[model samples]
Target: MTRIASCQCGQLSLTVEGEPALVSACNCTRCQKRSGSAFALSSRWNSNQVRDRSGKGLTYSRKGASGGNVLFEFCPVCGSTVSTSLELLPDVIGIPVGCFADPAFPAPKVAAWCESKLEWVRFPDGLLLLRDQTQPMDTR
Candidate 1:
């Protein structure tokens, strides 16, 4: 299946083909701050899987919990984070689940950085919770 995800202002767009390798919700402080929510939900895809992308979004890089840089791409007009790429996970692009605005989109299977997860936050049953991301994105 093909899916299209875009920023709030429709300036940035990502066209993803086929299914994602993994979907996750991260509760790291950076994720919370960037998403302005309890967590950030992302769907990972191989770089090649994303095609027909359009936009001139700005990128911001920050040191991640794994000590590697995570680059976030946001729409300059709306300041909405549309996608991310991690130095630790080369050739993989992570798309913000919310950008799709599809209620039927695949749900997150894992929750990472649970140590920083809000006390009031609750995860769905069968969701794997990790105190921190210990494995590579492809492994999970």
Candidate 2:
């Protein structure tokens, strides 16, 4: 199933397919700086499922300290960070859950980069927490 999503200004849009691979929150410094919030929600989906509308979305790419490039997709009109893609995670694209338009959507299943998690930040029940992206899932 394909779902159409757009930036706040609607200037940029794209279609993503199916349920996300992983829905999770990130508390890393980069995520916090990018989102300007306590944490950011991401829905990971296959990159092949994404189709662009305006064909003019802006991208901000940077080399990750962990290696590979991180690309952030956004709308030039509203300056919204809409979707993201990484070289390491080739098959998946991360979409901000906040952009889903439907507020009734489910929460994330994983809390990524928990090592950077703030001392006072809280996580949802039954969600997996990761100190780094490579960490193993902790059932506890």
Candidate 3:
């Protein structure tokens, strides 16, 4: 079955045949603005499986720390941030988990770039945390 979602105003929607490969909370300043929160809840989806149902999305992009461009996609009508894609990884897409109809998706398994985290933002309890993407996860 395909997993489907839409922006708050329904201006943009998506459909995917499977769950995300990963999920996380992004605390960077840009993510804060995109999410309108201390952090952005996001999940990973393969580029090929995600279909734009309500038409193409609007985007704002900039150079990232990787010296690559990071594109932020959103609802043009409602201005709701939806997903992001790195310049080098066009085959992978990161979606804001909040768009899901299910309000109870599992908590993020790990966090990225947490050094920029706000003081009041609480991460998932006892979850594997990261100050940066380098943080090791699990027993591997």
Candidate 4:
């Protein structure tokens, strides 16, 4: 199966094949700010999975809680996040799940940085929850 994730303005997009390697949620402060939400849901895919990218994206780089730089790509027109690259995982591209705008999109398998999670935040049962970023999400 193929999926397409695009920005609000439709200016930038990513077309990928098959399923994602992993889907996760992060409650870190940076994620909260970047996503403008309680947490950020992201799907990790191999760079090769991205078959097409439409339009140019504005790039922003910031140091993550993990101490590695995270590069964000957003639509220049609508300012919606399109995708991200982590220095810690060079070959993996992280796309915000919301960009897909699919209610059927897979749920996050793991929740990280729970120490920074809000009091009312909760995830489904069987979902791995990490108190901090100490553990890697792809351990399986």
Candidate 5:
């Protein structure tokens, strides 16, 4: 299946092919600050699975909680973060799950930085929660 995700102003768009290999909710400080929410949800796919990327966007690179570089691409016009690329995971792209605006989309199966998760934030039962990035991810 092919899914299209776009920025709020439609200045930037991404076409993702097939299902994502992983979907995660990150509660790290950077994620909270960047998303202005309790956590940020992302769906990860190999770079080859993404195509038809259109429009111009600005890139912001910052040190991730794991001390790796995480590059974010956002629509300059609307300032909406569209996608991200992590240095720790080469050749992989992470798209904001909310960008798809599909309520039927699968929920995140993994939770990262749970130590920083807000007290009121409740994850679904059976989710694989990691205190930090050091813990192994359950991609299966």
Candidate 6:
């Protein structure tokens, strides 16, 4: 199967093939600001799975919870983050689940940075909740 994730204005997009390696949610302050929500849901895919990427995007680099630099690419026109890459996981690409806008998209199997999660936030049963981002991303 293949999936396409696009920015709000559809100016930036990525075409990915096959299923993602993992799906997770993060409640770090950076994620909250990035998604404008209580937390951010993202899917991890092997860089090779990205068949195509289109449109121009601005890039931002930040220190992630794991103490590695994470580069984010966002649509300049819509100001929506399209994708991200972590220095610690060079061969992986991260895409926000919301970009797909699919109601049937897979739910996050892990929730990280629970220490920063909002007081009222709750995850579904069976979701592995971690207080920090030190755990391996592929621990599913």
* Best-matching candidate per lDDT: 4
lDDT of 3 by residue, 78-122 (tens): 887777898988899887888886776767888777778897766
Backbone clash pairs for candidate 1 read none
* Number of backbone collisions per candidate: 0, 0, 0, 0, 0, 0
Query: TM-score of each candidate?
Result: 0.94, 0.87, 0.85, 0.94, 0.94, 0.94
Q: Compared with the true structure, what per-residue lDDT tens digits does model 5 show for residues 78-137?
A: 999999998989999999999998998988889999888898998888889888965844
Stretches of candidate 1 exceeding 4 Å from the true structure: 135-140
lDDT of predicted model 6: 0.91
Deviation in Å, model 6, residue 87 alpha carbon = 0.4
Q: Compared with the true structure, what per-residue lDDT tens digits does model 6 show for residues 1-140? A: 98999999998999999988999999999999989999999999999999999999999999987889999999999999989999999999999999999898888888999888899997887888887875533334
Q: Per-model C-alpha lDDT, please?
A: 0.91, 0.80, 0.77, 0.92, 0.91, 0.91
Task: Provide the lDDT at 12 for model 1.
Answer: 93
lDDT-wise, the better of 2 and 3 is 2
Look at candidate 3 and tell me the lDDT of residue 109.
Answer: 84
For model 1, the local distance difference test gives 0.91
Q: Encode model 2's per-residue lDDT on 72-110: one tens digit a residue.
A: 989887899888889888888888887778676667878
- Give the poorly placed runs of model 4, Cα more than 4 Å off: 136-140
Error of 2 at 134 (Å): 2.3
Candidate 4 lDDT score relative to the true structure: 0.92
**Which pairs of residues collide in model 4?**
none
Model 6 scores worst on lDDT over the 10 consecutive residues at: 131-140
Query: Candidate 3 local accuracy as lDDT?
Result: 0.77
lDDT at position 98, candidate 4: 92
The reply for model 5, stretches above 4 Å from the true place, is 136-140
Candidate 5 residue-wise lDDT at 99: 92
